[model samples]
Target: MVIRDTHSLQLVWSSRISEDSTFGLRWTHSIHRSLVEEKYRIHDGQIILTEMSFHDYGIGMENELAPGEKLDIQDGQFHIRNMNRHFPALHLFIGQVRAGHTLLFSGTEIPLGSLHAPGAAITIQVEKRSILNEIGGY
Candidate 1:
């Protein structure tokens, strides 16, 4: 749920923004999420939250992030806004949120920071909701 914008990996959610849409015309593909992930599996319609951490020089590195600050979820063609929407949102547990979109390299760090750049270690809090629509499970 918690991921970085990851320029190397671009997951886009295709949606048509109305010219008069509340979200606005400039927002159709204008959405740029710090987190973009796809192809996830839920166990019995549930997600597990676990504590993640990191240590450098045998010491832990820590950073703080607020809710909906820098996170995004994107399917191959669907981008969830800042950990909001029906999708999952990952809360930062021990990392900092870069004000700008982070570029992750192949050697990016996963725990203590990306091999390429600083990465995100999150405290996952999963909530179960109706993933299906009243009309039908799209």
Candidate 2:
């Protein structure tokens, strides 16, 4: 995943560990630079990133989705809202996500993820926002 806003930016690489687990590396650019490595697990329908290591930046952080928090991953499309201490707010939209393919609707047709299976690889591009609170109204 690559998140780029006017105030912050992030680059992420993730690998599936199991049916509901993943390991990731994220680099954030803001007032300073930060490199974070983390593990994520799905619990009660929410994905939580834990066991994180933040290098270069002077803060420790974690990212998660609460149990009731929802992701609109229905009908092969989705809007992803991400918040983290290491970077600015981000919003991502995928036109399709399923086994063997992933498509982004933000006008970039860059192919990401494995062509052979689901969860093999994933990539996301965060749309930049002009205002901090304007989220494109998913």
| Winning candidate number (TM-score) | 2
lDDT, candidate 2, equals: 0.33
TM-score of each: 0.18, 0.29
Model 1, 5-122: lDDT tens digits are 3343321111222221221111111134223222222233233222221211122212343465242223333232332222243333233443232222222323323322434333
Question: Model 2, range 20-124, lDDT digits (tens) per residue?
Answer: 433343334233344333434443334454434443433333234545433334333232333222322223322133221233223333233322223332333
Off by over 4 Å in 1: 1-41, 50-53, 56-138
**In angstroms, how far off is 117's CA in candidate 2?**
24
Where does candidate 1 have its weakest 10-residue lDDT segment? 21-30
The stretch of ten residues in a row with the least summed lDDT in candidate 2 is: 93-102
Model 1 compared with the native: what TM-score? 0.18
